[model samples]
Target: MLTHAERKRGIAWGLMSLFGITLFVGAPIIALLSWDMETAQTRLFTAYTWRILRFTLWQAALSTALSVAFAIPVALALARRPRFPGRLWIIRLMALPMGLPVLIGALGLIGIWGRQGIVNSLLLKLGLDQPVSIYGLSGILLAHVFFNLPLAARLLLAALERLPAEYWLLSASLGMKPLSVFRFIEWPAAWRVIPGVAGLIFMLCATSFTLVLVLGGGPAATTLEVAIYQSLRFDFDPPRAIALAFLQIAVTALILIVIASFPAPDDTGSTAGRITRRFDGRTFSALFWDALVILLATTFLILPLASIVTAGFKASLWGLVTSTAFLHAARTSFAIALAAGLLTILTSLAIVAAREAIADMKRPGRAARGFSVLLSGTSYLVLLVPPVVLGTGWFLMLRPLGDVTRFAPALVAVINTLMALPFVMRVLTPAIETHRKRAGRLSASLGISGLSRLWRIDLPVLAKPLLTAFSFAMALSLGDLGAVALFGSNELTTLPWLVYSRLSSYRTNDADGLALILGVICLGLAILGTAGQREASRG
Candidate 1:
């Protein structure tokens, strides 16, 4: 029933997907295999390795616990008070950290919590004997909480919003107490989603590189990711780096498997008519507590962003704008982002198309379902292979062929594409699947196929999701520090690299200015992506 052209297109896309996965995921893994097993084994068993691994696990657990604990109250407050002033803006602001560069967020945290930060400044003015420091374990925890608290709050709030109206009505009719209502209703709903959220936050913190690298003041604060960087770039020990990379992958894979056991949080469902009429939290004390929670959450999320804007403007905006190095880095970042974004979108489309083609077959068998699963799962494989590990593996693979620095930019772009794959799939799959479901039979009846069918059907419907996915991919690549960190040199620097370089050399002003620029660009891309989604919804 399929036309020759359609069959050809499907085959081509399937092949393309295979090629991309092989090139990006397989190559580095193959490269890692080139190392001697005995050397890698020896490196893996050292006390230093075990210590770093333990620290990584400890910090991630603490961060996940703190983030989730703080988020519950804040999410409850947000859910209870849906009509509060600036509520929508606060929700949007919660997402800012998603698009904000890690280095920029770190800078903002330092500005507010560092030894000379406002809190410490106030303490000093009060004649306090000791100043606080935004370095080491505390700093790592603070940064992770700042980045993930909003995410957890948003997810929990969405979950709360999706609760049925009947539950609130039942509680109100029964005159249930606040404690009783939460025990009977909210706790059950939230418990289902917490594992997934916690797992994601833990993995993010565990694999944290940029924030830890900047704030980790000494060896005591180093994470597995930073250690891997040091092993390859500083120590020039390929075996040690390979061993660490393998350890990181194993730990991440185990976490993913655990997370898979939980019911995945559904973000795409309609919550429009689901707002429950709450009978709890009506007392003055309850109201005050909720208001206090919302205010504190808002302050925690917004103050660092405000600090970045103020510090950047006051310090070196003009000098940074006019500097040659800054311009080159910006250009490099832009090019890489553009290239990576396009590549991610194209590759995602191919894999998605192949899956659709499989589904469109007259009789999809076990093989078809398995292939579809493989296609979907390939995107997630990138999660297990951390960017640092991938970069290290590729470095080892390429070192013998030629100068690896020459290929750094391309490799960074490829790695960024891989990192963006999961996100791109999330955005595209739903749209593409909906389109195919709605129109596939009709297209088949009319014998529409290939470019004709695509142009007439798919493109018009998919334009918005495609654009949104591209913008998100670009934003992610633009702000990426991990992929570029291993390959960054004078000849191949990005804006993030420039910001980090300035920070390393103690050029705080320049770093602040560059951070601001990078943050603004990323924010713009995020806005662009969301704008398309908003328009699509309205249409």
Candidate 2:
């Protein structure tokens, strides 16, 4: 029943899937194979390895707990005071950290909290002589919370928004106190979403690289990812690097498995046309407390960004802008981001196309369904293999062949593409599925297939999602430090690398200028990505 063009498309998609598996999965496996079991086993059991593993787990646990704990009260306050002035803008500002580059955010954080920074300056003026250091475990936690609290709040807020109107009405009619209402209504709804959200935040913290690298002041503060970087780049010990990578993979796999065991929060029931109003938190004392919580949270989120802007403008912007090194780094970053974005989109389309083709079959067999699922799940493989681990593996593979620096840019692009694949899949899959369901048969019935069907039918409908995916992929690539950290050199420096270099060399002014530029570029791309969705909705 399939047309010749359809068959060709399916075959092409299958080949693409094979290529992805070979490149992403097989390449790492081959690199790890270079390690002898005796050395790997010995390295794994060393005290140093255990310490790194423990620190990684401990920091991730603390970060997840704090982010979720702080987010709840903020989310509650926001949900109850929906009509407050600038509430929407506050929510939008919270989302900035999610898209902002890690290095830029770190710079912003240091500007406010570092020694001789804003906070320390204030303390010194007030006769508090001990300057605070934004380095070590405390700094790591602050940065993690900064980046993740907003995400948790937004997720919790959405969950709060989806609560049944009946529950709110009952609580209001009974004159329920805030505590009682939270216990009886809000807690139940929010609880379901918490596990998945916590798991997600936990994974993010566990795999953190740049934050730890920049804030971790000494050997005691290093993470497994940083240790992996140190081992490969500084120590030049392939056996130890492979051992650590294996350990990281094992830990990541375990976390993923545990996360998978939790039931996803159900948003199946309808709550449309529900007007939300809370009876609690209206008293003088309650209002003051809630308002105070909101204010503190807002200040925490905004002050660092404000400092970045203030300090950046104070710096010699023109000098930094005209610097050849800065311009070269910027150009290199753009080229890599563009290449990564395009490749990510292409790979995502291939995977999605294959899954759809199989699913749209007249009667797909169990094997076909399983294969489709596998294809759809391919992007998540990148998540399991952290970018640092992937980059290290590739470095080992290439070291024996040629000067690795010659291929650093290509490697960075490939790694970035892989990292962006999961996000691209999330954006593209639903759109692709909906379009196929609506138009696939129509095209086949008309004997229109392949490029003809694509150009006339898919392109018009998919333009928004495609562009959104590309923008996100590019933005992610632009801000990436994990893959580039191991490979970046004078010949292959990126904007983020340049910022780090400036910071490392005590060139605070230059770092500030570059951080400002990087943050603006990332924020712009994120806006572009969201704009496409807004346009599609308006149309």
Could you give candidate 1's per-residue lDDT for residues 197-293 as a string of tens digits? 9998998999899999999888999999999999988889888888899999999999899888888877653366765577778899989999999
The lDDT, on a scale of 0 to 1, for candidate 1 is: 0.88
346-382, model 2: which lDDT tens digit per residue? 8888887676667657887898888777776677887
Error of 2 at 417 (Å): 0.6
Off by over 4 Å in 1: 1-4, 269-275, 536-539
lDDT of each: 0.88, 0.86
Model 1 alpha-carbon miss at residue 141, Å: 0.4
Clashes of each: 0, 0
User: Least accurate stretch of 10 residues (summed lDDT) in model 2?
Assistant: 262-271
User: Could you give me the TM-score of model 2 versus the true structure?
Assistant: 0.96
